[model samples]
Target: MMKFKFFLLQALLSSSLACAGVMGDKPETETPNRLFFAGLGGSYNSVKLDQYFNPLIGTTNIYNGGTLVAFGTANGPAVPFHTTQTTFAPEAQLGYLQSFSNQDWLWGIKLAYNYLSITMTDSDLVSPQLGTLTAVTGAGTGFTGRATISSIQTRIEHEFDLMGIIQHSFKNIHAYLGLGPTTFGTRTNIYNVTGFADIDGTHVDVSGTPVNFASTKWVWGGVVELGMTYFFNPTWFLDINYRYALSPHNKTNYTSAFAGTLANGYTKSGTLFGTTNQYITVQGLTFTINKVFDFV
Candidate 1:
């Protein structure tokens, strides 16, 4: 889905750029037409994560047979409460831009490294049962398998972008657009994981737990950006732009971690994987000061 979205976005951006190229086209050329440019900027970003759980966990449609409470409505997978921390991070970008076909028209590539993440779903959660994974249990006879998950910290990513660029220069103002592939080092963390299964009259804590767990991986995605730069002189400029980035649609199969011990003689242990697609999208506005040096 994310890939499809990116392709669609690419198509739209291409169409718009093509039309603009034809409508206000000019034969623009300059001395020392090739340049290497570098800049520092800040990107304010928002990340959104979506994952709906499998109605039935594992092979069982019923957990505790409606006798005890689960995480959701009639014993769900997890709880409703969640938290999202937003960050405004700095980005470092360096790239080469040069005129192609015309002096006013240019094509180049920009490479950037930055970090961001999306805020989780809004307040009211239709399904609080999402992200419910645990180690299976042993030792004690089961009564009602219940769990209290203190928190599931969301995902964070270090994103690298390699964008193909196109621009049109008019007087002192230059408008540009870019679209290309991206890569990420992503991490997901879960904390305070504890569960219970009522045996007889006692609620025993399900052990072999992942009290604090984290997993990391590499992912691929895409980004589309549009911006304009104001030239202070021929070699210096100030740029402000908006960028929209989409991460790949990925899967979750727990942290592959089951630690700690069970208080009850019979232990509980197992892992949970959601039955939904999880992805991230980022929208940012960046401001930068840049300098371009004439090269070959």
Candidate 2:
């Protein structure tokens, strides 16, 4: 789904540019051209995370009758997790802008980087029988299996992209479209879990259970951008733009190595994977003052 959305947007951008190029309108290319440029800016970004957990050691579904809880509904146990966060971060871009000697079309190669932090939490009530793998207990055992669990996750990432952009100038302003491949270095920290559960007639407090240690992954994605730039003068200009990025789903398996103890002293671990195409789309508002060197 994410990949499809990204490609769809790309195709739209391409079609628009192709049609514009066919109009046979020639732009004035007599203004000073920028040969190289660099910029620093601030970005207000929104990060949304979608997480899925599956216990590879046992049955994946553990709710009664194998039905998981529905979101915002009084359905069953094993509530779903969803979170969104807004962050303020800094970004930097360095690139070379090229122009034909007698044309108003501009092309450039740019390298950019963004750094951001995200923190979120999810909590729910789980049936104690969930601890019993493949066997349903607590019936006639005088013990009701019930517990409350909450998880807090913190993550930080450095994202980089190398892109190619094409722009068409009109007087003092120009509109541009860019597409490129991006790479992300992400680090995630899992804190101790908080909850309680009943196991085989015994009640145990599930607190500070080591669910996960710190982990990191390097992943790849793609980005598409649309924006307009206005020049106050040949050497200085203001740029405003919006971008959408899509990353492939990242999959990781949790073993005993990065596990912590559960409520009943059982090892806490699960196989985690990104569902729904595991991607991030950032809506950013950027303000930049740039200085361009004229080779002429």
RMSD of 2: 16.3
Provide the RMSD of all predictions against the true structure, rounded to 1 decimal.
15.8, 16.3
lDDT of 2 by residue, 196-244 (tens): 4354556644333434435677768888878787877777777777777
Model 2: CA > 4 A from native: 1-34, 56-78, 123-150, 193-211, 257-278
Query: Which residue pairs show collisions in model 2?
Result: 128-145
Q: Distance from true position, residue 10, model 2, in Å?
A: 55
Candidate 2 lowest-lDDT run of ten: 68-77
Off by over 4 Å in 1: 1-32, 51-76, 79-86, 115-144, 155-157, 198-204, 208-210, 255-277
- Top candidate on TM-score is 1
lDDT score of residue 285 within candidate 2: 64
Candidate maximizing lDDT: 1
- Residue 193 in candidate 2, Cα distance off native in Å: 5.5
